[model samples]
Target: MNQIELKSLLADRSPETPAGRIVRTLSERGSMSAAQLARLTGLAKSTVSTALSELKRSNMVVETGSESAGSVGRPATTLTLNPEAGTCIGILIGQSEIQVIVADVSHQILSDATAVIEPDYSPARGVEVVRELIDAAYANQWRSPDALLGVGIAVGGPVSPITGEVMRGGIPNWAGVNLHEMFGPMFDAPIFADNESNCSAIAEMTWGAAQGFEDFVLYTLDLGVGGAIVSGGRVLRGIAGGAGEFGHVVIDPDGPLCRCGNRGCLEVYASFREPLAAAERHVGHALRIADVVRLALDGDETCRRLIRQAGEAGGRGLGLIGSVFNPALVVVSGRLASAGALLMDPLAESFERFSLVKGRDMPDFARTLLRPSAFVDNGACMGAVGLVLRHHGQPLNLPH
Candidate 1:
């Protein structure tokens, strides 16, 4: 089938068509057996079989060998969308960097690349850098840009769900920028957009720490402290797109000024920016957040102390989230999460101390579970890809 047909099937939200349901399910879940597809799509076995037959005949589906489902019978054959049918692009616009990833419908990553840019880079500069990166990503691959199905963008700042405009605070240069308008002309397919934290949550739900749980929270402790709330298997992008901006939450009205222009915001105290600066001074040179995390993991007391302190501060913010949502699982994300127990122990401790419901007071099953993100450097970008795969956050008036 052509790209239009494939896109139409994947983007079709109607539940009456078995073919559309099967295509969308495979796009979201990657490879699966007919039985699994039937269960996930809530279609009868005979209907799924018919749809699969039609899809295979149209070269839209392909057999991916077999996977043992740990059953007594022989392994069931798996099926996935034909990788040659179409491709998707995921771009991440970070504070000081830009990343691009290319993947097929079968969830196979073809290329992933990043470029470090100066801080406060303008939107024009960002588009240029992204174009270059995307070009380089496909330079060696056999796939052509014409096969691209859609583009998903993960912006560092909050994006209005209604307007596709970036909000002020996270990325100063990106504030008020219309992402769909900025990136639309560059592609021939539909464009999807969301803030980085929300994209990270999508990545977690699809492939990482929060894989099985529908109700959870993703708390990111990085140069900035931000998070995303997931309930009923959907990320809660608040009205005007300010929902999970935990970092901007004002904790002290009279405290120091924050980058977001708010005084004593959670990010001012919990972010790793100040700690990284301190680590740089102690080491007599500049260091990335990962460097301090590595040093702490290697038994550096100073680095360990910094991480512990940040964790404690982060936990206080997380505790507030706990009191508010009491999510079943909290996935601690960002570069600091790489420190492992050095960060998690203190964070969890602080969370227990400040939260209204103490873990000790609840049974093991009732206690909130905390885990680190599965992806360290690429979660948001990959989540951008998930946005396209799952057909989430599609821009208005976009053609199928």
Candidate 2:
């Protein structure tokens, strides 16, 4: 490729050129054979071959494993973007914790780390802590910071799509903080940002339970309740990027006040806080959502009952979602989902009872499939990495 063309190719973001189209396809569907790429990208076989050759020579692509030969077809070799071209960082600025994930250009995670802090830590403190964690991570790795493409932040609040500011009603301390500016100076690459639930949805759509589905809902039940909605393979960011604020949806006007300044919102009852409080009283000590789940799985009746009640409460909110989106799939996320059948059994049963469309009333193909997340924890941070591999935005800045 000529220098001009090569630079254009490197700078190009459109999925039109053979390389851009191929990269976009890989980002969406993952590794594939050349034939599959041709089919998916609708590029002629010769064009694909030429582009692949150039990409491989430029260290932008690499050969992975191969799929089994079909009944009447030869085995086809699979290819993916080269892992060495660059890396991306995903960070989850959660309510009670901050998680950081380091991943390559090809979506392979190199390291994942987390640090718990007080619930209302200031943004300045958050930046300091995250910077330290990131420094420690790179200090232990062979990868250089110069190769990083970008950073994607998934906050535990509503993020304005245009301003990248955290909206009020969630993470009060983070409101009005410009995300791009907060983490921009630490790294030399570009930064992307979104809500934590949206990041979870991206993780699910990219590599987890909702892989094949274009539309789904990610309902997270933990110390807090939240969710994201995906429609036609794109996360539904409302006018203000609060489209999937399921937890804040008002359900009762006279009920307990929610943290978001609302009364009787879904999260008021669905969140694990109530259960955790009950567990603390019962256990006579401190307890985390994960600890409760483990105890429940171990057959602690009180713990089990607490989880069941939380699931039942969550269903009331999800039932409203069912009436609105009626998605084909519902991927239950967050730490509570790790409870497996202990949580899902009751959740599914309650969902069916409260939802507008009854599962028995629909055909098997039309039923809303429910499954737990493949990630037991830190899904949002991983999804931040997903944002980079997919080239959803400009490359991230490498840490100084």
Query: Cα lDDT for residue 229, model 2?
Result: 89
Off by over 4 Å in 1: 396-400
Tens digits of per-residue lDDT for model 2, 11-119: 4566577887876676556688999899878999999999999888876778998888688777788998777766678888878788888877566778889999899
Per-candidate TM-scores read 0.94, 0.90
lDDT of 1 by residue, 208-276 (tens): 999878899999999889999999777899877788889889999998899877799999999999999
Global fold similarity of model 1 (TM-score)? 0.94
Model 2 earns a TM-score of 0.90
- Lowest summed lDDT across 10 adjacent residues in model 2 is found at 1-10
Candidate 2, pairs of clashing residues: 149-395, 149-396, 150-396, 188-397, 189-396, 189-397
**How far is 107's C-alpha from truth in model 1 (Å)?**
0.6
Candidate 2 residue spans exceeding 4 A from truth: 1-13, 42-47, 70-74, 393-400
